[model samples]
Target: MNKLSRLLLTASSIAPVCLTLIFIGWMKDSRSLMIYSAITAFISWGLCWSLMQFAEYKLERSHKIIDSLSPANKEVTNYFLSYLFPLLGTDSIAEKKEYAIFFYLSLLFYICFSENYNFNPLLSLHGYKFYEAEDDTGVGFVLISKEVITDIRNKTFKVVKLTDYTYLHTTDRE
Candidate 1:
């Protein structure tokens, strides 16, 4: 997903929880509602920010790895990769379409009914890890796992290494 979509998703998820917490605190005749709300908002914002940073890091890392792979390997890798916050279905229809919807609904359910509403949907989602190889350009290399290598070797996908710099300089240099 784009940065704006991720920010909106995070905000939509966090706002309700913060408001609920603040309301509960107020209902309980807390010593200071303003202070309570302020603290809650701060914590919520911090958590959302941290989550977004982590997601961005993962997405960037995954993209770099995917880009470094052979064309065939890249195709397979892209097929399986799912963004933490997907705006729309890119590849297959079987993939989850409404990540933000599920996240928000799950979050709302937890906030409204559960005692521990600190659940994070991002952490609950599954993710794959690709091996990293240090490179001079800082773009680095990606090493597919043994299983993936084996699959490629078995012609699950035609694996051919291309020497052309077709994807080179696609992104900003600095």
Candidate 2:
């Protein structure tokens, strides 16, 4: 779906829950609770849009990289990208890529906004690592600092760092 559709979907999905929470707060006459709920809902909406933008940016960059590769490498990359998202079960490369982005963004939304908006840094790191590990084409690059990626890999994967920037190895490489 496009940006506007995604935004509308997210708002529709979140509206009921947000309304319920705010209603409960209103009934209890807890101004603080109602205010917090409204703020949280707004932040969640903004984050979803931001994540979609980031995904689009990454998709464009990956397309450029894929275009620059040799035909043989491009085929290999396309194959991996095509099968990255099992839940979607889609044969279309474009749909698979969109599913992967949605999956990561959903995970990020859960980690950042759910459960009273308590940000779990470790969960976020692990989620990114898991997403990266699943993509054989190395196209699912989660935008994070190099140092953060290095730390997460060292702590979770225990793999030797290959470089300062590009360290995570895809399964198809070895």
Candidate 3:
């Protein structure tokens, strides 16, 4: 994927935390913080949804032959939990707005620069399923598909490459 697209995926990855911050601000009666966080959360979610739709419709597809494929749904939680460390300090967020801002901005920079865009919750929430696939050479890849692939080992699939290590299945879309 391109840098900007990767950035969007990273932003969406933290959107759930932003939504949580919005709720916290609301419970604390911090209207300004609530509105601000709400705006950011919705924008991240909306843009992510748009980008996924664009990929499903406008991107070109090619076939990939894989020797093995299996469900990878559990991998999503590992990615999701990595963002919760700073949340420990968020209990006093109203008084620590600067710290919270710096914390999240730094998190965003780290994730983007690190290029960990494989397990986005937004992709799962948008009806995509994750799979671990390996080629005949034993090289591994992350594959995203809309359909539930119960048994498709040693099959060729129409897919679009999202990154050097990730692909999106192109068939069975509604």
lDDT of each: 0.33, 0.34, 0.73
Worst 10 residues of 2 by lDDT: 63-72
Relative to the true structure, candidate 2 reaches a TM of 0.29
TM-score of each: 0.25, 0.29, 0.81
Model 2 segments more than 4 A misplaced: 1-16, 58-174
For model 2, what is the alpha-carbon lDDT of residue 148?
Answer: 28
Once fitted onto the true fold, the runs of candidate 3 whose alpha carbons sit more than 4 angstroms away are 79-86, 172-174
The candidate scoring highest on TM-score is: 3
Name the candidate, 1 or 3, with the larger lDDT value.
Answer: 3
Where does model 1 exceed 4 Å of error?
Answer: 1-12, 16-31, 58-60, 63-174
If the candidates were sorted by their lDDT against the true structure, best first, what order would they fall in? 3, 2, 1
Tens digits of per-residue lDDT, candidate 1, 51-135, equal 4444443433312223223312232232222222222322221132243335435554543332221222322231212333322
Candidate 1 vs candidate 2, lDDT winner: 2
Deviation (Å) of 103 in candidate 2: 22
Kindly list the per-residue Cα lDDT of model 3 for residues 1-174, writing each as its tens digit: 566666777788777667666666766777776777788778888887787678777888788888888887664676557555545665677555666567667777887777565666767787888788886678888788888887676677888776666777886555
Q: After superposition, how far is residue 17 of candidate 1 from its true place, in Å?
A: 5.2
Q: What is candidate 2's CA lDDT for residue 153?
A: 24
lDDT of 2 at 169: 24
Clashes of each: 0, 0, 0
